[model samples]
Target: MNIIHSAVKRVVKKSLIVALGCAAMLSTTAHASEKVYRLKLAETWGPNFPIFGDATKNMAAMAEKMSNGRLKIRIDSANKHKAPLGIFDMVKSGQYDMGHSGSYYWKGKVPNTLYFTSMPFGMTPAEQYAWFYHGGGMDLMEQVYAPHNLLSFPGGNSDIQMGGWFQKEINTVDDLKGLKMRIPGFAGEILAEVGAKPTNIAPGELYTSLERNTIDALEWVGPSLDLRMGFHKIAPYYYTGWHEPGSELQFLVNKRTFERLPEDLQEILRVAMRTAAYDMYTQATHASGKNWSTIQETYPDIKVKDFPPAVLKALRDANDRLLAQHAEKDEQAKAIQQSQADYLKQVRSWTNISHRAYLNSQAQ
Candidate 1:
């Protein structure tokens, strides 16, 4: 009995030592991981702007949660920053550690920035995303932004955008001539090529501009956002989208800030941004579906028309010519354009067989 008792005591002593060692290791790890990183972000949208603003909030939340509180992000909207169009400069100069805006908005400052956003007649959301992740799109984007001390990522997608709200129907190519439209980026350039005067206006001023004849027509987003803007009240014609089919917004990070982050935190930010982008796309799709139904029920007088074939052809020709000119002027532009074109052709064939075929079969 004495021997058995002694053996039990020895086993208990060994177990206690093992338990204490584990506790010590856990305490030391907790101390080592206590460091926290905080970042500030500037967004182009006003405070609490629906789909766009939600993206930044979602991304911040995801980063904080995924990093177990090691990373935190604070967001300031355009109203706080007071410069919606200056996101590129703000992030590049490190005035803001990060920014959320459209990549194309910086075309004037960096011509290559134009390609990151949706092209005039580019791939759909799925195709574009595949191109970015698998077809070398992300690498090209990095090449374009790296020189400016900024890192850009896909922030969100607004799905397919509508062409615009017009006071009158555009029946022919001539109708576009001398037309004053509120468009932006490469699409605006294409309009200019076709003799239309295209201008960019702030979101807050769009309604007033169209109502007071400051602009003849303007394209906001699709039904997801447009219904709230009340553009239908002033302009009865809503043309279908052709310009930004898969409009992807961007998140810009300062290079110095990004490099300062630990590798794990850096990966957390990337994953957060990507997940938030997809969330925004799904949200946009849901909102557009709901709002489109609402429009049909509430505003039956709204005329939905497709651009005439002649106008489409003219626009396509203008797009090709502009692209050729850019390609001729810059070798990088040529490479990026070729990359996009090749990827589009490769994926679009499958898309026709899978998506297009399925849709047509269902319709029939």
Candidate 2:
């Protein structure tokens, strides 16, 4: 009887050992399957660039943390890549997995892309965010970029960009005629329609171009960023914004690279990009308020001006004509234009009742 009981105990112990070994093997297999994915990102901004650079770092950190090191993003700024404006082509060609740049920067390469960035006399930041997320903006954006083997996401917003710092005040429409300025995208086209010689200079060269009189005026960003660029020291006239009420930067991803990422990692990337974009907007707003206060206190000589009513009307008319010409040329352009106009019309009405009304009440 004792021998039989011992035999039964031995069999039970052996069975328990086999079950534990199987469990350990399964755990090891699951861990081994969580493969690590690393991506390279190219940014238009230089190394240590303030608000713009911060967005990329924030995105990378979030993705890494959320993914538990399974996903890693390495960013190379303009300093390293030596091609601030070439980001679109680089990512499309798969030289880099991702890129951070303004969608309007590629307007010369892809005309339809000009619509993705802020438009002249367009929606504010909040309104534009609504358009991108809730409206048909994302679908339209995908249609435009997918053919190029890339995916685009909103990188950040610079808030309402201040109109360019000017060597002289813009008193009339003629002032814009023969005016040499560094502006890009659809806004540049509008300036050309009004006889201004609009050009695009890289961000690094903007100060030198304006300082050496290579360009008579230039708009960088609002007080949030422009203050550091030292534009106020040279150009006394700082005009209010008419163009780029909501200047959104872009993130471009190689579609093939994105597709290779696991489902969990893809969602993590999307959430990280989205959160970084919103964080950038808030940072811009905060920095603008702080910097503007500093400018008012320290730089009393800086003259803030608004374009004359007549000049504004001429620019607005020119904007209408140019957009019409683009719409006439491409069905895609027409669709995007219609979508933006409709969304603006719908959202602006609510904005008028809410934000606009509230601001007016507070001012009184």
Highest TM-score scorer: 2
Q: After superposition, which runs of candidate 1 have C-alpha atoms over 4 Å from their true positions? A: 1-32
| lDDT score of residue 352 within candidate 1 | 99
Error in Å for residue 73 of model 2:
0.8
Tell me the tens digit of each residue's lDDT in model 1 across 1-364: 9999999999999999999999999999887687899899999889999999999999999999999999999999988999988899999999999999999889899999989889999988999999999999999999999999999999899998999999989999888888999998899999999999999887778999999998899998899999999999999999999999899999999999999998999999999999999999999999999999999999999999999989999999999999999999999999999999999999999999999999999999
Worst 10 residues of 1 by lDDT: 29-38
**Which pairs of residues collide in model 2?**
none
Supply candidate 2's per-residue lDDT for 153: 97
Compared with the true structure, all predictions reach lDDT values of 0.94, 0.95
User: What is the alpha-carbon lDDT of model 2 when measured against the actual structure?
Assistant: 0.95
* C-alpha TM-scores of all predictions: 0.92, 0.94
lDDT of 1: 0.94
